[model samples]
Target: MSGPSPAPAASDGITPLQQMVASCSGAILTSLFVTPLDVVKIRLQAQENPFPKGKSFVYCNGLMDHICVCENGNTKAWYKAPSHFNGTMDAFVKIVRHEGIKALWSGLPPTLVMAVPATVIYFTCYDQLCAVLRVRMGDWAQEAPLLAGAIARVGSSTMISPLELIRTKLQSQKQSYRELTDCIRAAVQSEGWLSLWRGLGPTLLRDVPFSAMYWYNYEKSKSWLCERYNTKEPTLAVAFISGAVSGSIASTVTLPFDVVKTRRQLELGELQAKNLSYQVSSSTFSVMSRIVAQGGFGGLFAGFLPRLIRVVPACAVMISTYEFGKAFFRKHNQERLRGPLQTRNT
Candidate 1:
């Protein structure tokens, strides 16, 4: 049999509600810090090279064309580069200079709405599932963090995918959305409630593998680091570094899925507007094929650099805050309940 099932952290008496709340709290705080990078990533992903004679979004065509037409840059295929954003710092500079600081937070509302609940569901389910898997698998269960993470993501993603779709729609828009509610209302009114889940297939494809790789890498890294340092608990530095490394690995592996998901969702919106059937771009394979046909392999990795930059810190903050939040809240809750109970007894 296995050595023993992993025990829940109960420094202050763990509860399901408390677990969910702590996860949500951590995600919300991280979201605020990461929202700007998120916007740049989304904008970069949504943009298409207009110079390429195809169905691309052609966002920077005018500017690029103006440059080429006027100054005549050496490389005619300079626009063939994967995405408009050169790097993280360049993305920030270009977005702020061109679109204004406010644009960097364009989809914050919908993202916040989704992220809290998504994190809550994901973390709670991950812990619960891990416990169950450990009981069944014994010693081998600890080696299966990827399985636990994938299972947990399924539950969380199914619940929150609609919100993810909405957030993507809002964020990837070339035009501004007044608010989250406006975007939701438009989706509902135009394409019925089903529109909210238009790209769930691709979301699952992206997220399931991403979560599996991320959680597995993180757990492995954390375990190694803790053992190397001979610590019972991971230090903040350890957690941050582990989380960042894991996030980067997972993100790079699953970036193509992310690109396909965004394209499918963006196309879904257009199809809905035109009242066309799903055949325009129905399947993930079809979308992938089209992307390859148009832009070659580079299309699959659009916005990778900015995504990497955003995800590393975002993942580090998320996991670190989650661990800290759980500890802090548990202690706080214990003291809060003790105070009330002690007064009543006195």
Candidate 2:
């Protein structure tokens, strides 16, 4: 029998630009698959006390009573219904049944706009920062991925938050600004341009630690998998499993912050606009307190299952594609450069 195939070189000749391109492509493709879950997660997170209601029809106007869980057409209190998704699969079915298949992709525009560039910047910085630290710290470079991921995520968040704010609002049932410009204009007119950064604080809280944990776990898991499986280059299955495990762990640890972030981004200003009562505070601490008071500790994990499911697969796809893309590009680019030299030698 032929000898086992040689292990592929790890990140050999993988330039920062190539890393970025690979990451961006992976993230965009992932977003397409997972945006529906994102929509459901946002809706679940945006649920608040005394939910909104309006617009009712008798013969199932694309919405079922159970699907819109909170608001019942027969309630005689409001025109619209509250969302009542059972879980991830239920959310998918309900959204498609009631709102049509297209509804699953709500806010996709802002998602892509934010995610593609954010991913590019994050991966590029991660690679460069790891390189610098690896040279300086030797073994300590193992921790570099964690710090680099966190720092890169925070840096990208400044730009990504505004788009996220818009997307959250668009995805939320509380308001429907059909156009991206409409959302921006409305926020500017109502809350000033600064409003676009509404949840930056909580976003940072969720993202920084999340990024650190995710990258750290991902790196460690990758190393462990390779060693356990007796492979140098991780197969796609190995990469996907490692990423899924890492993402699930990180997501679970950081879920409470995500709930707070979504609420702060989507509900705070809307409540203010409608003159509704909310024990509002600028601090995430106080917001967390309010959520706890409202729904007990369990409320902190409003969309935990869906978020976990979405993140696991999304992370798997993104990480695997990123690794594969880097490998492909690196090999192709080296071969291209070598061709000219080989011809000269011949």
Worst 10 residues of 1 by lDDT: 61-70
**Tens-digit per-residue lDDT, 1-346, candidate 1:** 1112225443226677878877887787777777665555435544532322212231211000000110122233222223377766787887777766776665455446656777888988886776667667866876567888999988887887675555444433433556767868877999998877666687789989998999888888887887778775667787889899999999899999988876765565555434455667568898999999999999999979866876778889888777676667666878988998999999
Winner by TM-score? 2
Consecutive 10-residue window with the lowest summed lDDT within model 2: 57-66
Q: Which residue pairs clash within candidate 1?
A: 2-138, 2-139
TM-score of 1: 0.70
- lDDT of each structure? 0.66, 0.66
Tens digit of per-residue lDDT, candidate 2, span 1-346: 0012212123356777778889887877777777666566544444323344422111111100001222322354321224676666776777777778877766465446666887888777766766666556666767777887888888888877776556544433345455667758876999898888866887789888988998788878888777778777767787788789999999899999988865664454455334465565758998899999999999999879866766788888888888788768877889998999999999
Model 1: residue 274 alpha-carbon error in angstroms: 4.9
Counting clashing residue pairs in each candidate, in order, gives 2, 9
Q: Where in model 1 is the C-alpha error above 4 Å?
A: 1-6, 9-12, 40-104, 163-197, 273-277, 330-346
